[model samples]
Target: MNILGILRDGTGKMAVGASVAAFVAATCLAALPARADDVTWTMATHAGGHWLEHGAQGFADKVALYTEGRVKINVAQPGALGSPLTTTQTVKDGIAEAATTWGGHVQGIDKTGAIVGGWPGGLRPEEWFFWVYEDGGLDLIKQWRMEKFGVVSIPCDTGETEIFLHSHKPVRTIEDFKGLRVRTSGAWAEIAAKLGASTVVIPGDEAFSALERGVVDALEWAGPGQNFKSAFHTIAKYIITPGVHYASGLTECIINKDAWDKLSEHDKVMVEVAGRLNLYESYARYGELDIAGWAKLKEAAASGNNEFIKLDDSFIAAAQKASNDWADEQAGNNEWFKKVLESQRATLDKLETWDEFRLPIGGVRE
Candidate 1:
């Protein structure tokens, strides 16, 4: 005992013993075998050559990186495996291991899907994120997917504000919407129908031909960049601003339940992280691309071939009123819809107070 005390106090033998123990533990850990199996998944998307598709590709790449190439994903362009409208079922039935789809497309399957996807006079992309991530929205989404579609859902991408109405005729007032044939979907379509406009549901790829053939007098399809990419300006001269109908659209990565369950815990987390990263990357990229698109539109406007019109405040107010009324009716009809809609509305009310007091960042242009 006297010799032990002397070594601890003067010889530093205790520190040497601790170091040796740490080395032994490290060596034992290093001797364990690593996970050796590699997994590759196939994912189908609802859109081809759009920013969302680009984001899907990014997710695949990032998943591989995060999983150290142990997990890989191959993304199929829109309609590759099945129609966009049927993608939810396709993923659920294991026709594809995964799918990237807008929530509205599956509303017919479950009304709750449209509310999560988007709603008229809805929260913007940033606000939607807070509701989904910070609030209990994500859990509700997962629950809904599991019960309704037998899949795991992750919000993977978000679109910017949609162009309210690309019209062949100028719509300057709420009254102007009467009898206006519009191509739209989800709640907006229902709201427009309530406001006396005839609404049609068509695939985005068919929008151009529909407009050209006079199948619809007006249509909404994404923001400036995507609208430009679709050459909407060439067909519809009046490009409406401030897309109130759909302020933002949320897209999701839907994975087959069995496939997702088969993934290791680490690989599952990597997939989730990749989805969130894609949301931010896609939003930022769309912002940059839209700026370039607006410049081109301005040039076209200078030649008197196109015009950007701001929807009248009164018209927007009326639309909001109709939207709220329709939402209430839907909530009345469906319990699950009511749960999600009320949650979102409550979140919006809480955010509105803070949003109103924030100072405007940039000056109004003359």
Candidate 2:
């Protein structure tokens, strides 16, 4: 009879009882007129910054506006609920109703997380969005979430290409990476390890202090704008260009499946529209901010305090090879990962010919 107690019980012995209780609760809630008028959800996020917070808050605002205040989402960032790595599970466990998170943080739970979140040598943001919107990627993501985490997820935001690394020493070549201590996560960490670097998986919040204290010799964060906001330039003199590890970032808005299913069809559609709007606005904002951040970095470089170095082509080629090998090994072990990778590669292959000619027309040259 006690709904919360049954839902919170850890033992599987109460599974049937809990299900019955949940169904009853849902039925009761649906009958209450006030329930429809006062729906609200809380979303947990990893860090607080323009790159993430703006989009998250924007989504919340749009959802509220679209639903005419019928539904509200409270955004909590800087790991208020838990670290980024744990937020997905928090949503899945019903401790939180929703989360705005990087998919890679949940890679341990589902390999598809890494692929959707942003894989090493992965598609660019536009290509990723194309795959998700037009090439069945969204359906695959939904299936993966339902099967792996008991959640529903949608792509809510896309981030620009990230800076490769912020380091105390220049990492110009593959050999230069040997013996370096780097802070990264998911497949990129695996690739870094293959390059003979010691890789540590630490929360983004801890990266600044870790690099400043010499705990990590190098680290990669979101991108130029975010790094500038975090004052990474002050801590590391070398700013590496072209984030080969993760070409573009994808942030997902995840909701517990039960919670999602409880929503009215109209409300559900509103949430989806809000997510799409957030995706567009977030990427555009990042572009504007990144340009401003780059100007500051250029100024610092001119002052001889900071230097931006492009990683050698040979090093990129080698890292790409390593990334491919890792992906192939993962595909051999996980069917879902294999499926997602195959889908992504197919999408990329189809785009390659178009890109070869399209990219050269008005592409910026150094």
**Top candidate, metric lDDT:** 2
The C-alpha stretches of model 2 lying farther than 4 A from their native spots are: 1-36, 356-366
In the range 1-366, model 1's lDDT, one tens digit per residue, is 121221132355332233432432343224433355797888888876564456678778767865668878898877788887778888988998888878788788677777888877677877777787667787888888888888999887878888888899998787888999999987787788888899999888788999999999999988888888888899889988778899887888899999888877656765776676677667778887778888888888889999889989998899889988888887898888899998898888888777579865458867
Cα RMSD of predicted structure 1: 10.5
Clashing pairs in 2: none
Candidate 1: Cα lDDT at 313: 94
Assess candidate 2 and give its TM-score to the true structure: 0.87
lDDT of each: 0.78, 0.80
Which ten contiguous residues of candidate 2 have the minimum total lDDT?
1-10
List TM-score per model, in order. Answer: 0.87, 0.87
Residue 19 error for model 2, in Å? 43
